[model samples]
Target: MSVESVVAAPVAKKVPVEREHHGDVFIDEYEWLREKQDPEVLAHLAAENAYTEAQTAHLQGLREKIFDEIKSRTQETDLSVPLRIGDYWYYSRSFEGKQYGASCRCPIDAEAVGIDAWTPPQLEVGAEIPGEEVLLDVNALAEGHEFISIGTVAPSRDGQLLAYSFDVLGDERYTLRFKDLRTGELLADEIVGTTGGATWSHDGTHVFYQTVNEAWRPDTVWRHRLGTERAEDVKVFHEPDERYWVGISTTRSEKYLIIGLHSKITSEQWLLDSATPEGEFQVILPRREGVEYSVEHAVIGGEDRFLILHNDVVDGVKAENFVLCEAPVADPSRMTQLIGHSDDVRLEDIDAFRDYLVLSYRREALPRVAVWPLTESGYGERRELDFDLELFSAGAGSSPEWEQPTLRIGLTSFLTPMRIYDYVPATGALLLRKEAPVLGGYDPDEYVQQRDWAIAGDGTRIPISLVWKKDAVAEGPKPLLLYGYGSYESPIDPYFSVARLSLLERGMVYAVAHVRGGGEMGRLWYEQGKLLSKKNTFTDFIDCARHLIDTGVTAADRMVADGGSAGGLLMGAVANMAPELFRGILTSVPFVDPLTSILDEDLPLTVIEWDEWGNPVADKEVYEYIKSYSPYENVAAKDYPAILAITGLNDTRVLYVEPAKWVAKLRDTKTGDSQLLLKTEMSAGHGGVSGRYEKWKEIAFEFAWLLDTVGLSGE
Candidate 1:
């Protein structure tokens, strides 16, 4: 199937809109594509979708084959490990033919105590369990909607009511609703345009949730009573700053409600006693630029305290990576350091429990979990949990009950399926609760996972994770698919994927470039790759690709690059900077017109992103710097690789117009006759689609394209 032999591509009409920022004037020809309500814009998007379908029609069989492979290897009829919350053991079940999971729970044994009481009930996948009650069947809720996303399924403290939210339009504005769990009937209270999560008050009379402002920043927290109208909900807190977002969550102990106000580089938390739903919230700490912190309620030495993970100064020295401190609940200003800051370790989160505190951090570019004992005297020794795999990810999972004796830890790697463990803090026992089933005679020994390093232009070493079938790569320089997401300090950790097996069995090598602008190597790595130094992310990725080729892992012609969202921005930058390094590029929801998007304060999430990408409107230097590297602005008349850009029509973040304009400009400017396609999900959002099966098909479509681009279609 020659892509070049397909019908002529859809040419988007050029309607120039001049944008001037910091005395710099630029003409955007495809700016008209941003209007979602315009019939012409919708028609163009439909035409582009038709063009993409016609071009990739030959790959439909292969897409189905890959999808079947994924389904065949996955345990379709499955149930997650039950988590104990209040009087019920809550879990979700997935059926073979179902698109969504069914939330279920069983009553806990009141007669049982200690280990027997805390241990989750082991329920079979298809077996009928005694006292099993279905909470929410998402499949039924998604009956009429083209797209449906379940946001929050929070149960009340007494387990009598459930507060859940759902989004049907894919714009991320959810409609919050209440359900009487005892009667299995929905209540009168309903709130619209929420940010998708609700925190229950201790007495179960009210729930606190957040709502987004015009800029799509969750800036207001509201408290809604169970039996009231939506308009009657009280505004608990509102963040006036556009750069900050607000979120509400109750402590694990259910003793306090925390309202966290955060920007990219700073944070301030407000705390209120959960016992009093109408009580005023007190500021735990004032927001300071460049200082970020998170608080967890803990009872130590028979006194209530706030466990704070912060990057604030200690003894006049800045704790950039962060340090753990404890302060009196009444006066949070008096802080006492519990764990000093470490330059090598990045403290990500801290969860407090009755017996211990779980510390989630990153060390040596890998996630690490540690348990600190809480005794009657004070804090005891801290023990770090160790895993055997060289390239794997391990973190604290859903252990919601504060008094539960065990910590749920989720572990996985490129070769290992997800394994959930209950870590006994008292005896230091790691009890394996469940391991995800992989059907069709799967074996981890058949695959190999390796960690390699590439030196950047500045002499900094970047880590690259490589995984492939041991036998498939014996011939050397096999077709490779390189994945990257280096933005927002988000790391692409090693994990097992059933869909990726389709690529590996087809003799393709998969590698992840843990470049800068990610949290893989700590805060310093992210700091180096963002704002003014953002180009380092693109160069680092290119260097990683070169290292792979130089080491005979894969040749340039056999390689295809993939990234989404901010990483899609990375893709656009790299395609313009080093188009010769890859045979093809696959970007989903690409932020190609970044400079223009950043310059517009009215766009969703643009104002809050100033800390990550500099404010081009205010800073002329930043304006020029971003324009110099922005992919849409840098599209040149040069031979480029086959490019496939995917986006969703209703996406609020990294709107669909960026990629539309990008592909349209690429078609006009690029010199090569290479395949350039844009596939837009007309009914979906930033996530592309809803439902597991639909998501799997989406992955299959992407995998098929990547395989075909790398000459592995016949495999």
Candidate 2:
């Protein structure tokens, strides 16, 4: 009997090497892609894009192919809403033969309000709860804004009050509002036009939140009384630190509020416990420098404490975090490494509940989940449960129904939409709740997930992820979009996307170059591509493209390279290196002037970012390296391929001024007949466009430009 299962059984097998990449055919395919084209097709492609009539006719064809491809390749999985919560899967799409029309508790469902086919769900996949209406329309709840969508939702400790937020159309401004889940009465509403987070005090007397200013930097802490409608929002805390951000969490007893100050990549937590919004604030732990700390909600032996997920600079920033013993702010001298990095894996998806730490992470290509009991002083031995598989996921709190045992997780992959489970933290055992399988006609077996490592000039192995329709590679160069982000320690992980369907179904090749500066391969991977070593990001991206061409994945001219922000900077630098090698180049909110960006500390995130990108101001070493590959400075008076650079009118980070300056320079200095076009979102900020349809339209328009410029139409 399954009385209590301790730790997950080892059922996940290692992913096998691909048959195609390992066989003799691999060499032939690589040579075939490297083989020079006949030049006849290339000439025709060029001519068609140049002639006005050909350009018009070709765009229509491109549109048809993109839609057809999206439908054909990703026909099995529901791309609408895909997330897992405790013992229950939360999605906007239909489930268990029941359909949602235009309102649901899901975030995406709320965003799709008013639009056709938009429906709301009660967050239930199947079956009915007694007295609980089998349905809840999220659309009806959106009262003030036409483009309102749920940003974040939080429940009081007693679960009596619920707080949520939404933003209007074309405006980055948000409205923080709360509603009584039981009474369904409007509680309180405040206009917050920034990236502020709303959470409640333990007793539910005070509502705490942090806000951002026009500069896009988080600046204030606002508090409101729970029962009052006319509660004045008095600012309780403010840190004028440039490029600094704060995250808040409260102790289980609600006696203390934890505030973490993050400057650049380093951070430390401070505590504040004020009865009124204007009460005195306290510092729990003194400030510590050069340490990276993160706070998450955790349950310890049926008691809740603010868990600190952190790592210290032992020998440089190549560090791994662990469960440090203490509150949100801990004794820096006593911070201990609870978990260590693996030789072939990285740890993530950490949460606390039921006296145990529930975690899900990747080992090689497989995913696994387990729990470690939260001991009085530290952490207990890790216990693995019955689920460790290739396509399974587990997490804490993806649902509101989970209560007993309280250990929950998410599981799914290429074929499965999502499977959520609630389990006993001490014992890995599934709890009864909901199962959300896709209702549409879609299958996961029609395509493949390929992982190939491309070796750079210095013999660094950069991982490249490829998702393509089976046997879709053509006898000639296939239309490919190569994407990468080489800064900010952001790992470009393997995740599914519905938007990618348009490309995959069209016999197009999609690739993600997990280049330098990403945490994909862990801390070392990030270290190799930052500051003085930043060139690694651009060079690594170039290597990924070269690898694709060299491996018969796709030819040079048949591809378009893309990135945004720092990745946009990546796109510009690489394009400059080989303008004749690409057919189109796409960038959004690009930081092309890397040297200038570092030099100007006044820019958003620039001053604080010197620790990551280096202050080229005083150090001659930093200055030379930055100028060596700064995209804007390197833009020679050479003709480039068709380029599409996107920006926002009010962007603060990366600044509209950045892309503004870069575009004007490109228009003046570019020698290529390659159309240099810039599109600015008049009302939006750093995020270019809003709304689902708007995003699709923006992407479609930009892609249309690529197809027209790269001569990939009318085939």
Candidate 3:
């Protein structure tokens, strides 16, 4: 990542002139673009403008209908009660013998329910703190109406002092609270109206935290001396600029603190020595110019050297590898690559136990954990920890094996919820701490997970994951939904899809296209699939459809592609490349105007994201490359498939206006009237339709769309 010598100190860059035509890779002139008026295009634009105006009412109606439907579908199931820890289970919050406080996601049976303890080798009913579940009739952890999960259970190193955070609305203004676990008494919460950002000092005698100050955007850090008599005793550590984000990484050593400052993407790492939280923060690494990689995070141990996780791409194509820099407290020597590059071995998690480097990664889309003795050169004699590592196109919410370098692991997959185990590297002994119990009547046999390789027209072998019921027809042109995302070196690994399972059981085939740009197959896969060469992603998706159809899995008419955000970008690009190859298209929050976005730097996250998209502004070659396929501009009035475009009003990353305008041109240009409907979340941000029930309803709506579009439905 090369930093341009000029920093945007004074309004940084010019406010990019809002382009008249999106997808215009290159234009003769901005003035000419704004001035040129083809009546035919303007006429099409007029009809679209009118339709968009009419949709103001239709969109309102749809919002009300969706909200009503969601509300009606929700509140149908009697929420589960929080259970106590016992032979079957106990609330972690209630388990006394457990080192940490017992907490569980069990349904609350009654209001103000209590937590109960449970041990596999069942503990005897002794004078230990009696485990019980005091169920709450209402959502105890409700986001707004009730208590929210403020910050993580901030307990002391000794599990004595506990600090936590909670908030109401999505505005993220949180309230910090501290409690003495032994006495169950409240302690001073130095920062009252705070968002989720707080950490404890190694000694547990002092607290370091940050809160959004005067500005609504940037934040400030503070340190609170524990056992203080006055609230005014807390000291302010540092105030970050509007463009920079400030955060603290607490280490076991009380002498050092890792201060992270970033303007979102380009980051600066600093180490500070604080007498109290109010101490000065000196610059450790004064903006490593042109070096842009997210600070993987650090383990503060002997000498307090930090192991940084950086996706150092040589030409900003595919992410290079994770590098470990031995920055002892104040020493930030250029850096060293602890682990070398691997298209397969993604540097997932680098954890430091008492003395080992627990390297958790995904190999060939399979979950793997490697243990190494921590050395200056990085891990040694890496031992692999094994479990089921399936690759679905979707992501896995469950974590992987290994609590840390201590040779302990906690593995969980989409299909397999959670499992805790202890491993001895020296003797190869594996001990199971806890195996996740099957809940919600989940059965793997109800469906299947399979991977197939499809070769594109250009000899590119693409991986496609097919998940459906075991008895699902092998030859039938089933109503199928294909998905893919190929950007930012993100790998869409194998993970269970509960919503997809619900659909697959109804005879619909769910497929994930492992195209280029994504770390699906590994480095080569990602490298071949990015930037100007990104056309491979579109062609590969088309190949996936053709291959599946040719193999008798499904015909063209039965294939429906779905992608959101970057995937949405994939969906739109694929639609343009092969419009008739699929039955329907769901492009949610898409970046349809990739060229325009890169050309215009005013867009939020655009300037910083140039590293990911390639600087078309500085580099003419990249500019021409992006302009060639910019989805919005290239959309000609052609016979196209049914397109459903969804966005959000408050999405700063991909503004609702992009979708609004894209759909406008799409509706006007499409040779056929493929139902082009736009749905916007009036309030939500990137993660749309949050909340368990709300999320489920949104899934149901999508399922309805695909079913309706492809003539397949469970109901």
lDDT ranking of the models: 1, 2, 3
**Cα lDDT, all candidates:** 0.91, 0.59, 0.58
Better of 1 and 3 by lDDT: 1
lDDT of 1 by residue, 423-527 (tens): 999999999999999999988899999999999999999999999998876587779989998888998999999888988888898999999999999998999
C-alpha RMSD between model 3 and the true structure: 10.6
Over the stretch 1-715, how does candidate 3's per-residue lDDT look in tens digits?
1123222111111123434333442332222112114454334333433443343332343334444544442223221222222122223332222111333223223333211121122223232433333321124445245213335545555555667665544345666667775576777554566647667765677777776655433356667777675365454455444456677874433445667777634667665653354556666656654444434334433345556666555445535544444444446555655666665576655655444655666666555677666555444577776554554221222222122222435554445444556566555677565544443566766666778889989886788887787775455677788888887667766554445555665678888887888875655566677766788878888888889889888887888998888888888888888888888898777887777666666555565556566787778778777777777767887888887776654555665556655665676567875767666654555556444555655666666666667776423
Give residue 713's lDDT in candidate 1 (0 to 100).
Answer: 84
Compare the candidates by TM-score and give the number of the best one.
1
The regions of model 2 sitting more than 4 angstroms off are: 1-61, 64-150, 169-172, 180-189, 227-234, 251-256, 272-284, 295-308, 313-337, 340-349, 360-369, 374-406, 411-440, 595-602, 617-620, 705-712
Per-candidate TM vs. native?
A: 0.98, 0.75, 0.71
Instruction: Count clashing residue pairs per candidate.
Output: 0, 31, 48
For model 2, the local distance difference test gives 0.59
Whose TM-score is higher: candidate 1's or candidate 2's?
Answer: 1
